[model samples]
Target: MNNQNSWKTLAVNLLAERTLLIVGIATVFTLLLLYPLFQMTPTLQASPNPPGEVFELQKDLNDKFPNSIHFTPFLLESLAGDVLTPNVLLEFKQRRQELFAKDAIGALAAGDLERQPYLVNYLDSETGVLMTGTHSILDPIEAGLIDIGTTLESASEEEVKLAVHRLISDPKTSAVLDFLSRHATHTPSTAMGHEIRLWVSPAMTFSVMTDNQKLGGGGLEIGVGGGPDVIAKEYLNRHIRDVMKEGSTSYAIWGIAIDANLEAQDEGKTAGIFIMFTVIGALLVVGLTLKSYWATAICGVGLGVLMIWLKGISSLIGLKSGLVIDLIVPIGMISLGVDFAVHALRRYKEELNKQYPPRMALKIGLSSVIGALILAMLTDSIAFLSNLSLHRSVIHFGSAAAMRFLLRSPF
Candidate 1:
């Protein structure tokens, strides 16, 4: 106990008496860690399961069928309630043609051409198409309309209705509608039984049929199966969304790639704004409460260091961050960091009020609260570390949170 007390006293003396030296060392350490933080590239993808039976089976299947294509599907929902109308169909046709146009897609990849001169690499190289092929509800209707010497452009409301009737009355085409209805939901048919007529109901409400099966809500789903790989597929998906957003009236477009891009945008663009506001709010509150420029400066510096330590250490240790970690970690760190800073600054102020010498006050202030700080750190860390048994993301959150708590305690 005496030896422990001696070491504690020695630490306090070093911090209070040798303040410049301690600050210099911390500055150097922070600078060193910044390099790794800048260089660190975290994997942003989320994987819910470990590499166990499901993954192994998938790998085996993939190996068995090496050339199998995973179709990235975009769901488009019409805001106008019905997709079968003449105007909507004409709009869909135009948008679909634009999506398949090489020049239009090349324009989207204009800046990226320096890396690869050809946009065909993002779609089908042989066909020079943006996607391999598309499966759309508009296909059959358009085909039926074409057979009757009319197009989406020339067809009137009465002409479109006649074309739909002809398609539904035909046995072969009627089978296709039956298959589509069985797979898709919110599709209004003439009969409630298995045999039904299309276009009998105008109002459509497209929704998910089950957990695994996904159908576009009330609009056509464009299939992106022909892209060379994941990157190419994502490129197609993003451009498709852009076209739909610009050309269509009211539409909800979503897919794996589309959703991922949206999330990445939120994190990349909006997170900085959120962090700026959080820092500003914290500093403002601290300034008002303390009413001392020096105290506020110290708190701000401490908070900055704590954040740097958290990010720098996590980067150095190769911890990956995605949407969940990026959102949760900083908020948690800032909240805890502000609390720790306030307690230390308030304690230091109290010591100063008691008429202690500056050095004595510094030592006494830090020493008085450090034990409680350490206890809080340990408990917080343990609680976060308890998530080790959960998913990989949860484990990362827990580990990073715990580590940040430990880093903040010392500051």
Candidate 2:
């Protein structure tokens, strides 16, 4: 062999041994550690699940010895009867305020219409819309005309409402209300009943059940009536802000991010396994083709290094975890590249075997197949690049593959 070829042979042998050992160790570690982790993944996921009920589970470590490494069972038992979380407190306050508001509006309506400061706006507390007439209001207290006198102040909400209804129905007090109650609830539904409208508090919830699903989204009129109060707006915003800071929402967010990562790790593993196997197949072909252990080893070493480089780059971009074959394709690339070189050399070796020495055989083989080797690679490149026209990502894939050809090129 030429002096140049001799150096090539030595370089290929030494590098191949070190690279192969690294690859083997890595494969073993991946199989032992990573594979087990991958397998245990399902159970790991199952362990932290059952999320939607995190509120019911309050875990507080019992610390009898604050300085020592000691602990006790969750102190949830102590919190049982008094387990009112922020959410419960919020709901209680909201319900309580609604009842209080309902009572206030009731008292306003139950009193004598001839007395009390009139509620100026006919407001729909639910929708925040307002009108001029007081009697058109839904809540009994907004009616300006009801004459309960001071009885409304002392009476229960139910009792106050009854007094207002009685006053509205009294023929002497309200000829128009007496006529309206014949067809419906004494509650006024027009601008003419200004005294009655002032009593309305529009925050009541209403729902109608139906047999027809098509009619479900149709004809719904919801409103809000309490007068515009800037202080309430700020308080409501604070409550919503507090809800967002709760632990359940935080856990749910972290759980989702972790679940995505686990899925990605699994995909990368599958791609890595398949690529490893493909490289092994290429190594076998190199073994069968080359007579020199050093020459065959060159192909394996170059392919392994290329595999590591491609994997490292893909991982840096996080593509390896999410992308399947595309991420692993770099593994098969080096072997494929050098296989062409080996095939070219092999053919010339057979021809020289008849009458030539190793150097003559090697030179002739390289000269004979260099063109064909490069031709095959060009063909492969064209085939891969053609797919780039279909997808933007394929363009990057083609470049990566073309790089493998360059890295794997042996004289």
Q: Using TM-score as the measure, which candidate wins?
A: 1
Where's the lowest-lDDT run of ten residues in candidate 2? 69-78
Q: Quick one: RMSD of model 2?
A: 21.9
For all predicted structures, in order, the TM-scores are 0.76, 0.35
- By lDDT, the best candidate is 1
Query: In candidate 1, how many Å is residue 149 off?
Result: 3.7
lDDT of 2 at 283: 70
**Predictions in order: lDDT:** 0.59, 0.39
Q: Provide the global lDDT of candidate 1 against the true structure.
A: 0.59
Query: Over the stretch 1-411, how does candidate 1's per-residue lDDT look in tens digits?
Result: 674477567777788888899899999999888887788845343344455787567657654554323244555555665555687667766765665464333543321222221222123333222332344446666777787788888887666666666666666565434313233333344322324334633222211111111111122212211112333434545654676457467444555444453345356446656777887888887888778898778777877887778878888887666555566677677777778878888898899999998878888898888778878989989988987753565667778888978887656
RMSD of candidates 1 onward, in order: 7.5, 21.9
